[model samples]
Target: MTSLASKLTVIVSAAFEEAGLPADLGLVRVSDRPDLAQFQCNGAMAAAKVAKKNPRAVAEEVAGRLKARGEFAKVEIAGPGFINIDLTPEAIAGHLSAMATDARLSVPEMAQGETVVLDYGGPNIAKPMHVGHLRAGIIGDTLRRIMAFAGYKTLGDVHMGDWGTHLGILFNDYIRSGEQDKVLKVDLDDPASVSALFEDMSERYPRASAASKEDEALRAQAQEATLKMQNREAPYYEMWQKVKAVSIVGMERNYGMLNVHFDLWKGEADVHDLIPPMVDDLKARGYAVESEGAIVVPVKRNEDKKEVPPLLLVKRDGAFIYGSTDLATVVERMQLYGPSKIIYVVDQRQGLHFEQVFRAARMGGIAPDAVELTFAGFGTMNGPDGKPFKTRAGGVLKLEDLIAMGVAKATERLNDANLAKDMPETERASIAHKVAVAAIKFADLQNQRQADYVFDIDRMVSFEGKTGPYLLYQAVRIKSLLRKAESSGSETRGFGNTEIQKFGDSDIPLALLLCELPDVFEGALNNYTPHLLCEYAYRLAQTFSSFYNSCHILSEEDEVLRGSRLTLCTLTLAQLELVLSLLGIEVPDRM
Candidate 1:
């Protein structure tokens, strides 16, 4: 199952050693100029610097050694020292046969038993999810899928903002609005009651927060309520639980629509108890000091080019802040999971905040040096005007509303294309949902994580061009082709037959691209970039389209050629499905 490029590197590396040159200078990659070669090795250029010999002379020596192996059809020196290699048709057929039989499509499991923890989903308890939460969920979920596929044990945590002064604000609002009787009488098991209570609370919260800024007395009442909840006072504690329960139900529904799930639904409140001891440990170890009346962890270093403020652990009133809970969450995760790496997928704007937290963790000896803490920061999703996305009315659009808009647009596109009109209404609806989800996820993931992207649903849902729907359509086309082949009794299972007489010009490019799938996975996993996979999927689909249009499969008189072409189609479909699945996109069997 070794990739063709890797196999070639091994052969060439041995050649370098046999020729009395450094074996490390034998790196081989897919040729940038496919018009001349299928693979290229520029190692001779670097080797010339070490051996003080002519690069062309070194390349000539390597080429001579390679020609004797018979694996390549052409071993010629191009330019000054570049080695251009063309594998024989038999060699390409051999590798394709092996890939067709392997279950993992020749991609190896690189991470084995390593453990990774992925943190995302930063929605607060009382508020609904907006477009701001979209990138983190999509990117983090894709990374988890990629890591798990690479053979790592990944733990995805929602890490919600369930505990804060916001809860106290909501509670104070509930009391002042004369709805205290509703909190006492509401049954948590009744969905109607819970839904109504949350709706009312959601509406009142903004009013309360705005009023608190103007009314000193109202602000003090909110502060007192916050203290009571933190202290676990009877009435406040009960109210907090009710609010948490109602909020989680709504949160799950919204997240479910996006097909985003988490193994840990933990939040700041989960680590509240650990904060006191963590702060005490930091203070005792001299990692924390009192700044005024508040406890803080001074993380600034002498080497820092810019000033970094201390991580606030406790406010002057003895209430914990976000840094305290985040630090405690790290301790909890390490104690429970013992992960080798913990990755935070948050907004890039919070880069300074994470820098301080990671530094403090290292200085306090809480996160061991062996464990890596990574901040996979991402940029914002903007509107057409190059600002953060908002509704037409300038309000933050809820995540569900955005999804609905996509689905509605997708349905309209389906109708315009006159697709799936004969299917049952339920099936067509399912296809639209899948298409919508794919469009939204792909539009977000296709951009580099650190770059801002415009959210355009119209462009994303198109069935042509580099869109998710286009990929899905191509996959469905392959499935239709396979069905026709089966009906005509064409041999589809003998992909291992290497006795084919010839390969179409287009066939080789598609096959060569198939061999690069593992390398693409490696690049994305190492760099934490899902857009690499997106680019690969698009190119693969486009390549297959060219191959299909040019190569005659069902009408070919040669049985061997027909079978070979069918095998290529089958492999392309499987790879397309695999890449899309890694991006958390679902492909319907028909649409």
Candidate 2:
């Protein structure tokens, strides 16, 4: 079914065409003023500006055309240029009923599906994931789920950082301790503890780095070991593999807790061999040149300006930078999947870095014109003090600790509410875990991805306001009623497939809101923002509350009216679940 806005746009477009004007100006959108109208066409003013006529006159002309059609119950031309529209009650009810039984819920899929490569969950090999990693993983996972639900064949890659100088720093620390043979052995059966190794490196790597600054010989030794590891020397390569295998255990644990997964664990080191060839191709194609003894791919934001420097592919000392690995990764993705779109979810701080990468890729013809490269940048999380979140010790907050903290807060709230006190221990454990994860994920996703949001466990797990727990509570409440209906043998067919020929005064508002889901969903998908879906879900739950409180469903004297209200409850629960899934939020069966 076409959206109401789309249908109105078609009608208005014809009017614009008949008036010998640009039809594009006749786009119809949801009215900003709810008390004024359900929908509005503001094209009159834009068209009037172009046609050199009065906006009110243009609106009157459009209103006359709209009135000739009997779909709308009221067609009013407000002051200046706005045309307010309210669909007939029958129209709204018919659309909503059709949506209830439709498998896809009247949300159309993309016209043609494309192969997509999504890069996210980028935790380096040695370091622990922090709240900063939380933002990228959550946003990228939601986008992946939404795009896949809309029929795109997507590949989620972790894009690990296993091949950088960070490895060398750790290696230097390991070798200087004089336990080289014992540590170099690859224990694939039972990997070494990553946290233990990280602790060791955390203490010693800085000292090694500091001593290397004053000692050129030590620096040279580190560089030599890095080269040997890259060149696949027996001892260094085995140690490298061991480090990679163990580090991934911690990485996967964090991802599993967040319900995030990657189809490919390809790291920067995976494309190491490809970089030399790529650099050679760039030089041959005249897209790269030698600058300060380093091979570089020059990128400029403006043709007349050269503020930002070029991307360094190879350092003078013969080492590949992260940018080089990124370029090789593009070529690798193109060779394997030939995706139409490659989306990167990273920090907004990396805006310039991605710009440099994409431009360099396009200049070198690594990304073809048909391939669309998009970087969805997100803001950082902050503490209540409005600074970047850190531990009391002024260290980075580990993601695992954050999860544990969320669960603790949720459990306290759940106990305080005295909910499910007699439930089995296993069920309560499951609820606590789900609520904790939901609180963390929802708190991050409820705001626009580009805007920094304060991290607060209390607010997130609260049962009131626009919190994840509240949405879950609403769903659980509906389930309780539906169970009650089943026990009483009350017919609920009114909610499944039956169309309403009439509505109570209180039902019209919800019916209208339900009809706008397709438009809201489409907008959210196009804008690459899940917060919009959060908004629709919250407003829907709020409306359902009003409907439940004021109108009697299970206790109504009129059987047909009661069944209709039951159906409304069922549809609300379904839409709420669908949006929550889109946002990657979990709803418990019980509060």
Top lDDT prediction, candidate number: 1
Residues 1-591 of candidate 1: C-alpha lDDT, one tens digit per residue: 667898899999999999899998898999999999999999999989999989999999999999998788999898989999999988988888788888898999998778899998888887777888999999999999999999999999999997788878878877777776666667889999998887777677777899998999888888878878888886777888887888889878887888887889999999989999999999998999999999999999899999999999998888888899889999999999999999999999899999989998999988999999999999988889999887788877778887888889878876776666677889888888998888888888999999888876567555568888888989999998888877766654433343434577778999899899988999999999999999999999899988888877778776777778878888899999999999999899877
lDDT of 1 at 469: 85
**Residue 402 miss distance in model 1 (angstroms):** 1.4
For each candidate, the alpha-carbon lDDT, in order, equals: 0.87, 0.80
Query: Over the full model, what C-alpha lDDT does candidate 1 score relative to the true structure?
Result: 0.87
Worst 10 residues of 1 by lDDT: 492-501
Model 2, span 419-491: residue lDDT tens:
6687787877778788777777777888898888786645755546777777887888898888888788775
Listing every candidate in turn, what is its Cα RMSD in Å to the true structure after a full C-alpha superposition? 2.2, 2.4
Cα displacement (angstroms), candidate 2, residue 176, comes to 1.1
User: Clashing pairs in model 2?
Assistant: 495-567
